[model samples]
Every structure is written in C-alpha cells, then in structure tokens.
Target: MRLALGVQYDGRPFRGWQSQREGGTVQDELERALSTFAQMPLKTVVAGRTDTGVHGLGQVVHLDTELERTEFSWVRGTNAFLPQAIAVQWARPMPEPFHARFSAFERTYFYVLHVSPVRSAMLAGQAGWVHTPLELDAMRQAAACLIGTHDFSAFRSSQCQAKTPLKHVHQIDIRQHGNFIHFRFRANAFLHHMVRNLMGCLIAVGRGRYPVEWLAEVLESRERRLAAPTFMPDGLYLAQVRYPEIFPVPAATLTSVPWSAVWSDPASSS
Candidate 1:
C-alpha cells in the first residue's frame, strides 16, 4: 500500500531534508521513526528537498508499505516515535499510482522578514531580520514583474540540477506588518535558491538600491551574477503543495488562524 503523509518541521537543527554523512536530517529522522513501527526498513520520497535551516508547513511525502494500518493509527503512531522538531500531522491512504514527488502540480513558498534593527530571540530560528526598514510598496511593485512564465536563469542557484531554466510563476505577493514583510511565491516548480534569489533582488528594490524595472532586465539577461546575494534560509518556508484533486482544499467554511498556529490547531488550519 502507498500512503501520503503531511509533515511539518523546524529545520534549524537538522542539516537538510536529504540525508548527509555527518549530521541529522529530516529524511533520516522520518525513516528511523517509521522503521521502529514497521520493524522493517522504510523509505519515503518527499515532494521536494529543502535546504538546511528552511522550514516547512505543508510538506508531503509518500511511503511504500506492505503492512496495513489505519490512517488514524498511523498518524498517532508516527508522531509518537518522531521528535518534537518534526511531526506527522496527517496521513491518508493513497492510490497505488499516486506519488508524492511526481504527482505534485505546484509548490508555494513564503519568506518572513522582520526588518527591524533589534533582533528577536523568539524568532531566532524562524525569521530573518534586516537592520534597515524595507519599502513595502516598492517590493510589491517589483514582485509583480515575476508573474508569468519566464527563463529564470538569474534566480537559479549555481548548483541547481534542473535540466531547464524555464518555469511558470503563478503569483508573487508582498505584504507587510509593522516592520515585518512577507514574501510569498507560487510556481509550477522552483529551481534551487530561486525564491531566495528573487527575494534578494526585491529587497534591493525596497532599499532604493535598484528600480522595479531592473527586474525585467535581469530576467531577460538570464545572468546569475546580475542578481543580488541570495537571502537567508531562516526566513524561507515551504508553505504548501498542490496535488491534483485528491488533496485539494475543499470548499468549506474556514477560519482565520495565524500561520504560526497551524501545528496547534490542525482542524481549523488544515
């Protein structure tokens, strides 16, 4: 049987989503927890691999298992064995053909910027803090240029393993609260460091270092060197993933819960 699992994590302590030789990783922790329950080796495939210090609110993974277990039990069982930094929020029995990595239609990421001079102890592992005030209006205007399909060579990381540079960006929204800024992006898929790179350029615009029109030129040039330095990984979050209809957000009454409250109130947030 195949099972789809929704996971949430604080990626600060772990090396990254993928396993590494010297340190703990999200994949390593998950596999270890499942092994104790199954009494057999269990491997899981994630929708996407997140870099170190990058968090996830709605990460999806698929695990193949022959043993039959109820969804309710599996959810509770997995969490019981998992560490506090990561949790198995939900698990559903998926079709045999449904794959976590290949079936995903789109992915969305969010970056939180507490753009204040003073550092936050509570948000130390969660958000990035900038010493200067950000121009929210300018950031919004600059973000608008990223909507639609484009060859995003300038934003991709030099180590990106994607075969092509073309990607379709569905939307980019910039919102602000006091000295905090939220940068959200949705796309069919993202190249390595693409969102962080875009945030760097947008931040540059917000600081009056670059004009909004310069983003168009950077996209056209497709030159990586032209973009500003990539933003911090602490602020990045894998906000959500779009699966075809199976995991779609049902049309139902929803409540307003702060993004920080998702893990605390699963029913209202999910």
Candidate 2:
C-alpha cells in the first residue's frame, strides 16, 4: 500500500530535508523512525526540500510499504521513535498515482522578519532580524513588481540545479504587525534560494537602500550579481502545498510559527 504523511519539523536541528551521507537531516530522522515502526527500511519522497534553518509546517511526503497498520498506529508508532523536533502529523492510504512532489500543483512560503533596534534571544532561530525599521509601503510596491511569470535568474542561486529559471509567481503579499513583517509568496514552484534572494532585495528596498524600481530592473537584468545578498534562512517556512482534488491528501495546518494566524486575519495588517 502507498501512504502519505504530513510532516512538521524545526529545521534548525538538522541540515535540511534531504537525506545526507552525514545523516543529520529531517529525511534521515523520519526514515529512521519509519523504519523502526515497519521493522524494515522505508524511504519517503517529500513535496519540497528546504534549506538548513528553514522550517516546515505543512510538508507532505509519501512512501510505499507492505506493512499494514491503522492510520492512528502509523502516526503514533512512527512519532514515538522520532525526535522531539520532527513529527509525523497525519498518515493516510493514498492512491498509487499520488506522488508527493509531482502531484503538487502549487507551493506557498512565508518569510517572517522581526524589525527592531534590539533583537530578541527567544526568537533567534524562529525569525529573521532587521535592526532598521522596514518601510512596508516600499516593500509592498517592490513585491508587486515580481508578480507574474518571469525568468527569475536574479533571484536564483548559482548552486540551483533547476533546468529553467522561468517560474510563475501567482501572488506576493506583504503584511506588517507591530514590529514584525510577513512576506507571503505563492508560486507554481521555486528555484533554489529564490525566496531568500528576493527577500534580500525587498529588505534593501524597505531599508531605503534601493528604490522600488530597482526590483523590476533586477528582474529584467537576469543577473544574480545585481541582486542583494541572499537573506538568512531562519525565517523561511514552507507553509502550504496544493494538490489536485483527485488526491485525498489532507490539508496540513501551519504550525511552525506562532504568528501563522496573522496570515488569515485581516485585522493583523499594519
């Protein structure tokens, strides 16, 4: 039988989602726990792979197995052996055709920034910090220019292995709450470090280092050198993955950050 699982993890504890030879990865830990439960080795394919220090609140993965267990057993049994920072949120039988990565139609990410003169030790690995005040209006204007299908070479990392730099950005929403600013993005797919690189540019605009028009100029240039430095990964979260209705994968709630509720509440905006 084929099964799909919703996974949540604090990426600060490991080296990202892929299983590495060094073995300190979310995939490695999850496979280890699943293997323990199945009494045999099990491998999983994730919908998206994240970078180090990037958290996942609604990541989905699928695996094929011969072992039969109740859905509750799958969740409880596997999580029993998993580390505290990683969890199997839900598990369900899936059609053989349902692939975690390929079946995904869209992916959403949220980048949270804490803007203040003094940083908070409590939010060290939980949010990106900006000592300078961010201009929300300027950041919003810059973000609007990036909405559409375009060759996002400027935002892509040289290490990216994606065959094409062309990507469709469906929407970019910027919201501010007190000293925190949220940059929410929805796209058909993302290139490696694409969101982080874009965040770097947006931060520059918000900080008065760049004009709003610079964002469009950079996009048109298609030069990575013309973009700002890739921002920190601490605040990036894989917030959602959308699949077709034919696939019955349950919607996984975003729980990696405390401010996720702000995304839905209209009153949270500055």
Candidate 3:
C-alpha cells in the first residue's frame, strides 16, 4: 500500500531533512522509526528538502509498504519510536500514482524575525533575530518585484540542483505583529536557499541599507552576488504544500508559532 503522511519537526535537533550516511538528519530518524514500526525496511519520499535548522510545519511524505495498518495506527506506531522533535501528524493511503514531491503544485513558506534590543532566549533557534525594527512597507515594496514568474538565479544558492532557475512566485506578504515580522512566500517551487536569499535582500531594504528600486536591478541582473547574503535558517518554516484536488492531504496546523494566527494574507500589491 502507498501512504502519505503529514509531518512536523523542530529543525534545531537534526541536520536537515535528507538522509545522510552519518545519520543525523530528520529523514534518517524518521525512516528508522518507521522501519521499526513496519517490522520491515521502508523508505520515504519527501515534498521538499529543507536545510539544517529550518523547521517543517506541513511537510508531506509518501512511503510504500506491504503491511496493512490504519491511519491512526501508523501515526501512533511510527511516533512511538520517533524522537520528540519529529512527528507524523496524520496519515492516509494514497493511489500508486501519487507522488509527494512531484505532485505538489505550490508551496508556502514563512519566515519570522524578532526585532528587539534584547535577544530572546526562548526564540533563540526558532526565529531569526534582528536588533532593528524592519520597515514593513519598504520591505513590501521591495518584495513586490519578486512576484510573478522570473529567473530567480540571483536568489538561488550555488549548490541548488533545480533544473532551471525560473520559478513563479505567486505572492509575497510581509506583516508585522508587535516586534515580530512574518514573511509569507508562496510559489510553484523554490530553489535551494532561495527564500533566505530573498529575505536577506528584503531585510537590507527594510533596514535602510538600500533603495527599494535596487531590488529590481538585482532581479534583472540574475547574479547571485548582487543580492543580499543568504539569511539565517532558524526562522524559515515550510508552512504548507499544495497539491491537486485529486489528492486529499490534511490541512496541517501551525500550533508552535503563536504569531502565526495574527498574520493576515494581504491581497497581491506592489
């Protein structure tokens, strides 16, 4: 049977999502626990490969196995062996043609920045930290240039293995609640470290280091050097993954981040 699982994790504890030979990744731990639960070897395919220290809120994974188990049993059994940092939120049997990564059409990511003179001890590794308050309007204006389809090489990491740099950025929403700023990015797909690169550039603009128009020039240049340095990975979260209507994946909740409830989805604007 083919099964799909909605997984969540605190990225601070593992070395990213992909399985490594040294076995310190979220995938390694998950597979080990899952294999134990199945009483046989099992492998999983994920919707995205997040870098180390990047959290996952609505991650999707698919695995094929011969053992028969209910969705509840899968969650309970697999989680029994898994560590506290990782969990299988929900599970369901899927058609053989369903693919976790390829079938996904859109992915939503959120980046949180804590602006305060005093660093947060509780949010140290969970959210990005900045000493200065970010100008939401300026950041939004700069982010406007990123929407729609474009060649995003300037925002892409050199190690990215994506077949092409062109991607459709459907929306970029920046909202501030108290001292915390949340950035929401929705796209058809993302290159390795693309969002972090964009965040670096946007934060630069927000901090008065550059003019808003400079972003357009950087985007047009398509040179990675022209963009701001890639931002920290702590604040980035894989918020959601959207697939076709044919596939019914559970709508995962963001319970860990309290500020997530207050951020509104603004209409697309420049």
Q: How are the candidates ranked when ordered by TM-score, highest leading?
A: 3, 2, 1
**Each prediction's TM-score versus the true structure:** 0.91, 0.96, 0.97
Give the better candidate number (1 or 2) by TM-score: 2
Query: Least lDDT summed over 10 consecutive residues: which range in candidate 3?
Result: 261-270
Writing each residue's lDDT as its tens digit, candidate 1 over 1-270 gives 888888888889898899777649999998888888878999999998999999878888998999898888887888889899988877888878788878887888878888877898988878888889877888888877788999999999999998899999987867676677877788999999998899889889889999888888898899999999998899898878878886532221112215443223443223
lDDT of 3 by residue, 1-270 (tens): 889999999999999999999999999999999999999999999999999999999999999998999899999999999999999999999988999999999999999999999899999779999998778899999889999999999999989999999999999988778888988899999999999999999999999999999999999999999999999999999989988888888876776667767553334211
Ranking by lDDT: 3, 2, 1
lDDT of model 3 at position 148:
97
Tens-digit lDDT track for model 2 on 1-270?
999999999899999999999999999999999999999999999999999999998899999999999999999999999999998889989888999998998898998899989999989888999999988899899888888899999999889989899999998888888889988899999999999999999999999999999999999999999999999999999988889998887876864457878776754221
lDDT of each: 0.82, 0.91, 0.92
- The list of candidate 3 runs beyond 4 A from truth reads 264-270
Candidate 1: where is the Cα deviation over 4 Å? Answer: 246-270
